[model samples]
Target: MAWSEADAARNRELWTQTNADYTAGSAPAAWAREEMGWGIWQLPESQLRVFEGIDLEGLAVVELGCGTAYFSAWLAKRGAHPVGVDVTPAQLETARAMQEQFRLEFPLLEANAEETGLPDQSFDLALSEYGASIWCDPYRWIPEAARLLRPGGHLVFLRNSTLVILCSEDEVPAVERLVNPQFGMHRFEWPDGGVEFHLAHGEWIRLLREHGFEVEALHELQAPQDAQTHEAYDYVTADWGRKWPAEEIWRARKR
Candidate 1:
């Protein structure tokens, strides 16, 4: 189904409230962390090295579904010209606040990642840590990312692994065995009126190719031994993650 403005508004409303709750949680530390972390487990980029070999200096980076935009702040510190885009006003507000707290300044736009209406071929890199990767439909946002990037520009995003999705039902923690079919997985409706999208591995590869992106890597992420499960992200236990991939990062270069 197409992601309509109403759907975007609902997601915005959902995250606006969620962002308020994050103020009392780990969100603050995430913004100010010495190193970049990915996903619920906050796996260190130092070990994963997702962005290594790619120079960030002076690159025009656009972060789709940027939420609080901590990643953008990191990119800015590394000398990239970063712009954060999100549909949730509350999230963008917090992002703005962080820019001040860190004494860093970058553009933050209140816009949907699926169709940002930004200029074509305007960015050298498109990033979505957990933002558009889960919240926006890949069919929509992947194309938008391609259109936003200059030729050979990169796109990187992180999302829940398909294993976690197949092993769990709505709001329940993931189990050891598959609970859902793999073939027709895409749009998922949660009990809290939240809609998330997940694609099979093959499907993601195909979609990225369809959008003029050459698949560079798919890093199925394993939780470190010392990784702790937080109450906010009770979907998958740390043990389960260590045995099976809980999150993944996809890297692609626009053709």
Candidate 2:
């Protein structure tokens, strides 16, 4: 389904409340502080090593749906000039707080990821860790990301797998069985007033190609048997995730 302004507004409210709730809670533990992961699964970039060969020194990077801008802060610490954009003001407020806490400086803009209004070819890398690519329509953001990146620039993002989406339902806590059809599943509306986006694997590839991107790699992240359960994602039980792909990371280059 095509993304609408209504969907955007709803998602902004959902994330705003989510950030506020999380902030009101206790501080993160040492494990969370050290891992610096992407999502509820908390897959560490240190282990995936997707950015191994890429040089971030003095490079320009843009992070879409940059909730608390933690990854953007990480990029800044590594010498990259990073800009974080999010649709929700509350999230940006938290991001600003994090910036102060980390003693890092970077621009954090409140804007929709599908239409960032950033300068053309302004960034060397576009990143989203279970962010815009999950919340915004790919057809819209894929082209926007293409416009934001210089030639040969890369776009790397992690999102939930189609299998997980099909098996899970709104407000439910576990991946029981395939509750939705595998084909023609695009937009999902949650009971908590949030919206999510997805596409079949082939559709994603075609959309990326249509938007002037070269598919480089696709990583299917599986949950280890020893994976610790996260309170935020009780639906993705370790056993269920081990049996099926829980997340996928896409690496595409702007051509």
Candidate 3:
């Protein structure tokens, strides 16, 4: 189902609260400096870098749902002209603070990912790591991303797999048995008024195709049983990730 305005408001409120809560601590800054990872497993991007073949130097890139703009800043450091877009002002504030702290200059826009006012075909690449693609409705954001990208431009995002989404519950740290059916499970409502999104693998392919995206790669990230669990992400366990895919990365190109 498409998210209503009420759902948008609720999600905004939820993220606002979340940003405020995280801002009270210093962990986010420290974690931002750590290796780039997909999810709780925190698999190092150095070994599985998504932008490996793509040249980012002087490219126009945009990061959706860039909470602290760390990834965008990283892109800027690589010589990409980066812009960070987010809905929550608090989060953008955090991004601005990080910009100052790191002495990097980048624009951070307070805008919803689903309807960012960025010009059409304005970006050479778009990125989201555990960001807009996971929280916003893909039906909306996928097309928005297509609109933003130049032809042949790439869109890469990381999100929780449907397997993980099915097995988890809001505010619960452990990944137990499946709590929801796989088929037709698109929206997950949290008790705290937050709404998240997920889709079956085939559904994602269809959606991307419909939005003028050519599927390039789909990676299901798994962790080893001995891999250390990320203390910050309480929802997923190493054992569970070892047994099942916890996160997925999608690499697509605007066709």
Candidate 4:
């Protein structure tokens, strides 16, 4: 059900510890670097196709709520001056180590988006893939992103659509209920432990406008027919994946 004070406290503690581990050399949880084909960098290849064509050379970029800084590193490799920010020191530490291991250099900041204190219009672009956009409240973040960018700067993001997540179940009945009756995202709690939230299609679009972003494009990841699937398929699929335009690859500009 609902998040408890104890649960939030424990999550905060774990998040802190995890970030520390990241900074100290332990890999961030989501990246799964040890896995054979599932490295976090796989993002820019497919989910972020738009970035494939952009010239990032020498641009000042920030990876907000960057978990392991993989995206930041990737941007740096493309000649962008990428800076990564996250709430967990451990994760930043892991990012630092990764930077050293790869002979890459970029800055990392430990701060929350709601109060980053980074200079206004400091960055030319902001990139976040499955990190800050999904877990944190965008109601506060839209302005923070706007504040971080110049008047014409861009924000690129990827997030699971509410519909894709709800229809992930194999049963036709459940899928029908999600698509027809409910037609929205559901807050789910894991059996092992932990609670997560999701946003609906209209809600996402509304939040962007509320924060003053001029929406450029929003659509699905559009997996190929022969694309590989994650093991979690048995549990849930992102609503955006069902077509019907669920989850999104979003690009917006500060007006």
Q: Candidate 2: which pairs clash?
A: none
Query: Against the true structure, what is each candidate's TM-score?
Result: 0.96, 0.92, 0.91, 0.74
The residue-level lDDT of candidate 3 at 215 comes to 89
Local distance difference test, each candidate: 0.88, 0.82, 0.82, 0.62
Each prediction's Cα RMSD?
1.5, 2.4, 2.3, 5.4
* lDDT (tens digit, per residue) of candidate 2 on 18-131: 887874232223112644665566678898777867898998999999888777877887799999999989878877776666677899998999999999999999999878
Q: List, residue by residue over 5-94, the lDDT tens digit for candidate 1.
A: 767877888897798776425456867788887877777889888887899999999999988888898888889999999999888888
Global CA lDDT computed for model 2: 0.82
Q: Please give the range of 10 consecutive residues that has the lowest summed lDDT in model 2.
A: 23-32
Global lDDT for candidate 3?
Answer: 0.82
Could you give me the TM-score of model 1 versus the true structure? 0.96
Model 2: residues with Cα > 4 Å off, grouped in runs: 1-3, 23-35, 174-176
Better of 3 and 4 by lDDT: 3
Best of the two (1, 4) by TM-score: 1
lDDT of 3 by residue, 129-246 (tens): 8778888888888989999999999999999888888888778754668887898988888777778889999999999999898988888898966787777665787888888888
What is the C-alpha local distance difference test score of candidate 1?
A: 0.88
Q: Ranking by lDDT, best first?
A: 1, 2, 3, 4
Please give the distance, in angstroms, between residue 236's alpha carbon in candidate 4 and its true position after superposition. 3.4
